[model samples]
Target: MKESIISVEGLSHKYSSSWAIQDIGFEINKTGILGLLGSNGAGKSTTMNIMCGVLNQTKGSVFINGIDLRKQPELAKKEIGFLPQQAPLYKELTVDEYLLHCGYLRQLDKRMIGKAVDEAKERCGLTHFSKRLIGNLSGGYQQRVGIAQAIIHKPLLVVLDEPTNGLDPNQIIEVRSLIKEIAEERAVIFSSHILSEVQLLCKEIRMIDQGKLVFSDTMDAFNNYVAAQSIRVEMDRPPAGEELLKIEGVTKVEFLTARSLKIYFDGDHEVTDRIIKTSVHHDWHLREIFFDKNSLDEIFAQLSNYTKSVN
Candidate 1:
């Protein structure tokens, strides 16, 4: 079995009187990219802060690589690279200087600091802008610099909250690719409300709503979990609803647009094969026979709606 790099058990957080996050639990294995998805004020940032040791947990515990965050914060943090939603950059400092400073902050040897800074800059494609002050760089470049600072210490896990929050299409693509490259060795847990971004970057997803976990699974598993596969059959004029419902495993049938009937089936072998065999027997001129699967956004919306209804 793969070792879990980050573990949260019965974790909860409160601000004064109200709970920001309540009893959220999940784990990220090493070398995995887990997308932490939620709506605005859904406690994504609050959870990340607790994991990174920036804020104390109100209840329960978090362990990174078996090191308790609250017990040995410094040691636990050494295994983490955190990039918050806001890019924390010293505007006056050049990219190279800021990265070097980050290395020193991590207690790297003086002799190794320069080499580490260069490596981080190279990985983030900031080698050319090393001497440029962060304030002068474009927003995308500044974000790269921020990412460079985060990985200067070569931590075991990287936590980025909304890394691609506000960027142009090109910039977003660059950052997404950069994230993919960085996750080659270590685990990455990035929080985002953008469903498309999560779909593009993460192999596994953990969705939270109203401070509670709604779902956790791999991308394929998630799609399968919430998918409603409809077998759309095209014919000039087919019998109406009840005729199709007579078939085995056919749950519901609806007329979609013109000259098409979308039949909802169990998506099992027996049902799909039966549908095909039925079509052949009927000699219906089937223009199309395919499953219309749902996208990640659609799945998320369904889960969100269920959460609201339950609450």
Candidate 2:
């Protein structure tokens, strides 16, 4: 089993009588990216703040690398690097100066701070603009500088809250690539409202809604959640839904527009073969037979609606 680097047990938070997050439990393995997904006001930020030691959990506990956050706050926090939705930066300071200051604040040895600063700059692709004031840099470069500061001390976990919130399309791609490159070593806990971004970047996804966890699964399992075991059969004459559903291993069928029938199988490729055999037996001219792919956005929406109904 993979060792869990971050663990939460019955973690809950509230504001007066209202709950923000209730009974949230999950584990993030080392060296993997976890997409902490939720819509705005879904308590994703609240959960992240609690995990990073920015806020005390109203109930339950958080463990970072086996160290209980409540019991050993300092030790647990030292392993975490947090970047808020707004990447807090010293506007007047140059990128290098700010990063060096961050390294020192992380308590790196005087001799090592310089080396760490250099590494952070290079890794974030900020070396070219090292001497530029953070306020003068473009939005993308400023974000990079923000990342450099967060990783200056090389913590075991990096938490980014809406890291690409305001970036242009090209800038978003650059930042996403930077995040993937950074995740090669440490575990990354990222929160975003962008479903496609999570699908493209994260290995595992934790979806939350109205302050409660809705589902947690790997990308493959998530795909399965939205995807029916269906084969898209293209033919000269599209079969009716009921007619196709009657085929062996087929649980359901939907007419997707005109010539495409999404034939849902009860199980494996055996159903696909059955569909093919049945189609041939029916004298239906088959053109193409392939699995129907589900987009992450559809799955996200379905889960969101389910959460709302349960709440």
Candidate 3:
């Protein structure tokens, strides 16, 4: 079996009297991205901070590449790169100078520092801005510099907390593409509060709510866990409630407007096909029909219940 790149066991942290995270544990192998998901102030940052050795956990252990993070921080951190929500940058320095500084901070050999900085710059598309002051770079390029520094040491794992938080749509796309490339050869912990962002980038997701890990599984498993409860249907010539109730598998029908309705199902297969056929037969003029994705809050509630039930 392949060894895990990072292992977190029974991790817990307290800020004064309140616990920020409790008994949080998970492991990631040395490839692919794991999305750490939560709402704002849901302990996502606390967890990332502890895992990246920025803060000491009040309890439990974090092992990066089989080395204890708290015990052998210097050695273990050699295999981990971290970019927190706020980019750590010296805006006054040129991109090249800043990257060279990061290389030294990461403790790279003097002989390898130049090559490492160059490679990191190339990988992050910062070669053109090598001489430009980081302070003068756009928000997107600044984010790139942040990411470049994270990878400057070529760590086995990279922890990024909301890398796309402040970027525009175009910049978000660019950073996402860069993340994809970075994860190809190493493990990455991508922390974000945005549910859609996690859905788009990660194959697996870990959801934290109210200082607890409520769900930890693959994205496919998460989708399966939360069964779609309703579907939205728009019709031109809509049918009455009495007429629609005659269909199979539909438990409830809520009309939002004269032409739009919400249909609730009881886990029945082919409900859409049946609805489509009925619409054609009755000339209800079905314009569009699609299942409504469960909201993040709804999913959190469901997972909370499951966690309670299993425990």
Candidate 4:
């Protein structure tokens, strides 16, 4: 297997008297998008901050591309590019000026600052906005500038914290595309509380809850593990709600429309197969059927309970 790009082991942190994150550990591959998922105040920020060397961890370790973050802060930081939840921008500065400043902050050679700034601007679709003041640009463009600064030094691992927060739908789409494009060459850690965004863009997921690593797995596995307790089916010729309830493992039925309904099951996913068979027998003419993943609250609660039980 290829060596990991980001390695975190027993990573932890405390704020004042309370633990913010505890025993969080995970690894990122060299290329692709990995989602750091959690609710607000779930310690996602603390973990990202520690990994990016912006905040210190009280216990554990973070290794960025094999360099110990805490031991060699400068060297380790050279391999990382970070965007906190809020985009750091000097509103008065034009895109060009801000990027040049960032290049300096990254300690790029004076001779390379211009080239690096241009390249970052081009990659982030900010070439045309180079002369525009950071505050004058739309929220989407400002976000692009933030991303541009993060990549000015061309780091190996980019950690983004809630990069899509508070953006219009169109802006969010544009930013998501930019992130995917960026990940093609380097590892990207996209953090968000939105489940659908992670489901749509990530290859793997590391979920934190109540300051602990509650779930870690591939995206497909997560889909399968959390879904199927409920399913929505649309049929051209549907049966009465009572008739459908006779199937084993079925718990409840919710009618959504004259031709559609949602089915809730206890545990046996085979209940879907049975429903299919029954539909065929009754000539219900099933048109569409798919399992519905639980709501974010449901998944969080379920995972939290499981984690506590394991501990």
Largest lDDT belongs to which candidate?
3
Cα lDDT tens digits, model 1, 244-268, are: 7888989999898677888888756
lDDT at position 273, candidate 4: 95
Pairs in clash, predicted candidate 1? none
Give per-residue CA lDDT, model 4, range 1-311, as digits (tens). 55579999999898899999999999986699999988888899999999999998999999888889999999999989999988999999999999999999999999999999999999999999989999999999999999998999999999999998989999999999999999999999999988889988998999998899978998877766665588899999888889989989888999999998999999788998999999999999999988887765577667878877886
**Sort by lDDT, top down from the best:** 3, 4, 2, 1
| Model 2: residues with Cα > 4 Å off, grouped in runs | 1-3, 227-231, 237-284
Q: For candidate 2, lDDT tens digit of each residue in 38-104?
A: 8899999999999989999899999988889989998988888999998989999998889888987
- Write the residue-wise lDDT of candidate 3 on 1-311 in tens digits: 65579999999999999999999999997599999988899899999999999999999999998999999999999999999999999999999999999999999999999999999999999999999999999999999999999999999999999999989999999999999999998999999988888989999999987778888999888877788888899999998877877889888899999999999888775898999999999899999999988876678678767666765
lDDT of each: 0.86, 0.87, 0.91, 0.91
- Winner of 2 and 4 under lDDT: 4
Alpha-carbon deviation at 41 in model 4, angstroms: 0.8
RMSD of 1: 3.4
Give the range of the ten consecutive residues with the poorest summed lDDT in model 1.
267-276
Q: Give the RMSD in angstroms, all C-alphas superposed, for model 2.
A: 3.7
Better of 3 and 4 by TM-score: 4
**Deviation (Å) of 202 in candidate 3:** 0.4
Clash pairs for candidate 2: none
TM-score of every model versus the real structure: 0.86, 0.84, 0.87, 0.91
